[model samples]
Target: MTGDEGPSYTVDDALVALGFGKFQILVLVYAGVGWVSEAMEMMLLSFVGPAVQALWNLSPHEESFITSAVFAGMLIGAYSWGVVSDRHGRRKGFLITATVTSIAGFLSAFAPNYILLIALRSVVGIGLGGGPVLSSWFLEFVPAPNRGTWMVIFSAFWTLGTIFEASLAWIVMPNLGWRWLLALSSLPTSFLLLFYKLTPESPRYLCLKGKTADAIEVLEKIARVNGRELPSGNLVSDHEIELQQIDNPSEDARLLSPRTNEIKHPLGMDSNLGGISSLSVLLSPKLARSTVLLWAVFFGNAFSYYGLVLLTTELNGHSKCVSHKLQTEKSQDVSYKSVFIASFAEIPGLLLSAVAVDKLGRKLSMSTMFFICCIFLLPLVFHLSEGLTTGLLFLARICITATFTIVYIYAPEMYPTSVRTTGVGIASSVGRIGGMICPLVAVGLVHGCHQTAAVLLFEIIVLLSGICVMFLPIETMGQELRDSVQV
Candidate 1:
């Protein structure tokens, strides 16, 4: 009577039949809106840090605190929300993050003191920390063959978000002030709230949790939206699909094997495990090694990527004495322009990733980009001319952006649906440690007359990250998502 008692069809079957259509398009738009909102919140720090420094007459150390506070909150949110999504449902996390980010970010603009502003920004970060879940949520809907490309494309919204924020800062900071920039940055997230009601919980998550009727209902809605019909069967879990494959014997079975180096399920995890138990799965024998390498790569990527973004303001502003226009321009104008131009470098990087992830494979694509990033940073060790320095930073930004996007696309594919969000969340939390440390080296150390040391530090860390990526256990180029940990 509940529509749950019947023979079942695999969720992947229904997804493939659904293909890409209006349902997915709406998912992309709403998810991209969330991506854009998080990017604006992150980029807000670089702009806000300087404005507040001048306004409050704070030192570099105090200014760095403004930037670090957000990362600290993100570190907590990433792991906590990851557990929450995996245990409760992905949809719950989406609604809560969007609501929290919008409210806190908008209120930060009205802070009476620097302390209050930092507190509000931290709360905003707690919400922004859930950003990685958007990728996990989006990927569940994509067909396997196109997942890499679509995920990379999904990440492109991040580039759009950064550029949009930079442009807004360039225009608003001069005329209105940082408060207006803060207030305006919070507006895009409102879009997520508007359209969220129309969105469904990830069907993959639903099926794995044994909510077959709910899963079928969601798929039925998707089928209707895409102008197609379901494949005429009940909804089933991934484990059931694997057992049926064992009896049937096909390419699907081969892909499910460990020998194929396809999707490696996190060993010894249960469907009911939540929070700390979910995290422990990452340390199981099968996933333990990959988890460590992923954490290192995440840390290095965050440190280098965020450090370079923050460095744009410092590096370009440092050149004011050398360039004719720079010498006459307002500090804010030069800062925003440098951030704007630097952000555009991410476009080609994202384009290359979209193509390379499917062609060259995840490991090679990520390793290549990381090495290239290190190469671009090597020139900055010694002070160069304004034009050359800006050019070098642009190229470096391209590679780092690509690596960051590819890594996010790659990580979720490594784990099963049961803990995919948790695995990514833990890795991202580790990455937040790097983000928190970036301001110190990028601004604090660089400002303290150790620019060469700062540059060299990033160069070494990035090179090691390239090596680390090559050791990831499996390549998830076109693999179907694993639903559970099975022998």
Candidate 2:
């Protein structure tokens, strides 16, 4: 009995000796910082869109191209980073991404010509390509039960960053100009790197790499943070560890192995898959239907969401006139203040999403939100009055934001851990293609028939997305992650 007790104490003591409580908080903080970096990258472009147009004398089409270029880079980056993270380690990929993105963001601000701006914006996308990898890394560390809630919280930071950018643009763009605003956005990335430096690598990543000792060390740190101690009997043996070690092999030798070869050329598919190999995996007969449906859902939603946002300044000229008239009695800050308030509306939606996602179930919540969004859009298209259109836009924004949040959470969970980030990255990249196309489409429609036509196109996209959402397999909620996929 004494010996048994001793072993238990040894395990517990080892964990206690590690001091994990403080460490886990630090990890969460690091994750939060990463979220902020992503947020800043996303929001900065939206806030500065008007300013860039003014400075560069850009037509709406050129502005769309600049924005689309960033998304294109992101699409490529997401796939690249996913593979890198799976091959290397999450922390390494994250650090490199932060460094490059921060540098690119600052450089983009200083871009002197349209070509240079496009190139730099693409670089910024490449830097942001690390987002899905970081998201996966954080998800793997947290307990399954708490995963949804934590992910929601992480996403909320995105909204917070949006608000921050909107506020900054309102204040700084007028005084310091848009370039300074772009430069200022890079500041958070530096803090993110510092936070990453202090945080431990993912325990799951360590386990995957056959580093059992290191994995245990990280777990002990987590246990300590949670104010719990590990039991000696519960301790895992090296033999019990499932991960395989590379055994210090040469790179060529490593690539020649069956496992590595399979990863390189999966499912006896094409030999020259190029960067599209990961995407090809999603197109398999088993996954093709889901893949196509998801693509449609994402495309439709992104087209509508981004189209609406991009056309915000154009919608309901009468309403803008009214707003302008009302603001005649208000300060110069009135428009800025209204933008700030609309930005904040995303906060509550995010918070509610974080709290309700797991409980409400992904498919149901998402579909319901989409349906509500469709209802809101109907009013916008038919009512056509300035005040009614503006009110409907607000309602639609909240609904669409919540639905998109569900898609982000649900999309990644649909794939296996092996290709989780890859799948999500490709999905997101596809959505960026839509993001690129939507604005152009809006511009064409608006040019032909004014804002009403643009609004109608958006409504069609939303309705299509909603219908696609209904067809998706509603099987992810409450299922164990490993067990989530049907195949």
Q: Each candidate: RMSD to true structure? A: 3.8, 7.9
Listed in order, each prediction's TM-score against the native is: 0.93, 0.80
lDDT of 2 by residue, 116-206 (tens): 9899989888888788777777666655555577677767766777778778878897799878998998888888776676667766555
Clashing pairs in 1: 8-234, 9-234
Candidate 2: lDDT over CA atoms?
0.65
Write one digit per residue (lDDT tens) for candidate 1, span 157-229. 9999999999999888889999999999999988888888888999999888878889888999999999988
Identify the runs in model 1 with alpha carbons over 4 angstroms from their true place: 1-8, 242-271, 319-330
On lDDT, the leading prediction is 1
Residue 484 shift from truth in candidate 2, angstroms? 11
